[model samples]
Target: MSADARERGRIVVGVDGSESSKDALRWAVRQAELTDSTVDAVTAWEYPPLYGSIGWIDAPQELAGDIKGAASRALNHAVKEAVPPDQTARVHCGLAYGTPAAVLLDQARGADLLVVGSHGHGGFAGALLGSVGQHCTQHAPCPVVVVRG
Candidate 1:
């Protein structure tokens, strides 16, 4: 990374393969362009909870790998779909193993801004802001921009 880019600061955005998230990614890119800043496009994943008749069960290692791979692919696809080809160089993709809100918060620690969609895949359809977005806005170390799809 160039010193100029670092001086300009970073913009962290959450991507969840949802329409709303795509909108947020696009918005973040636009803001980055205007500010001459770099963008970190992040997607988070976690092992699904498993249960057996006896009690909670551990997820297979292969299952965990598959889930992480899916998250990676989704992040790439969201970037391809939402970011313009010419401006893609300004965006860096990241995949973290954790809840979306927590991962985003960690990524935004020193970032100039954090961006998220109003609603992701897992939330009430009519809600103005999804749980992740709400949590991020409430707890992020930097300012937040919530984009609507």
Candidate 2:
């Protein structure tokens, strides 16, 4: 890490290509600006479970790659939409293959703050807090901020 990076704080936010996630990204960016911190926007994906007549089956490698690619695209899109062009330099985007909560927690390991949407693409639509958000708030290594969209 560069000396400048070490001196500036880091904020990790989870993005799931959902409206709420976008709101969370926006909130994180504003917070980063105020605190002079850099935002790490992260998205995670996993191969969908396939069911066969015999039992569970592995997803094809090509299909898995496609899913991963989609996740990357979503992360990029979310960052582009949420961050202002002038503030782009303050944001870093990343994608990982894992559960959303786990990936976010990992990214926030040494961060000053962990941010997430109250409700993401998954979970009950009427829920005030999505499963991933709840998990992150409860388990993140750093202080967590749950933004409601």
Candidate 3:
């Protein structure tokens, strides 16, 4: 960490292994490099327990393992694909629980810029911003970047 690294804030991206998210990740990497920031490429995955937050239980034991494994794999693979070998040194990866919008909003607490893809599984073409992107932009503690794809 340098002077700016101490002074600068995090540049976080919400990714789910989608093409649009890959675009956001790429943009976030460049922003981090130019701004002397670090990339916090984040992926928020929901597990069965989260869906059962209302006190329901008894999900298969494999369910937890499977969701954690999938989330980690997606986070790692996105970092590998979006960040170049040289820029890799500045990259960080994280996986969390809850909805994409909620997760990214919480991550915004420490970030200077929160980046997200314009579309996900539920977004339509030419929508400019997806639901998560829209939520972060309006609710993030810092600046939000919607990397349109």
Candidate 3 C-alpha lDDT tens digits along 1-149:
66867887589899899888999999999988898888888888776543465777656767877987898998898788878999998988888888999989887787888989989767777677788888888889998888877
lDDT of 1 by residue, 19-121 (tens): 9999999999999999988999999999887899989876887898899999999999999999999899999999998889999999999999999999998
lDDT of each: 0.93, 0.92, 0.84
For lDDT, the strongest prediction is: 1
TM-score of each: 0.95, 0.96, 0.85
Candidate order by TM-score, decreasing, is 2, 1, 3
lDDT per residue for candidate 2 within 1-149, as digits (tens), equals 88988999999999999999999999999999999999999999999889999899878878987898899899898888989998999999898888999999999999999999998877897888999999998899999999986
Model 2 CA deviation exceeding 4 Å by range:
none
Candidate 2 structure lDDT: 0.92
Where is model 1 more than 4 Å wrong at Cα?
none
User: Least accurate stretch of 10 residues (summed lDDT) in model 3?
Assistant: 47-56
Which residue pairs overlap in candidate 1's backbone?
A: none
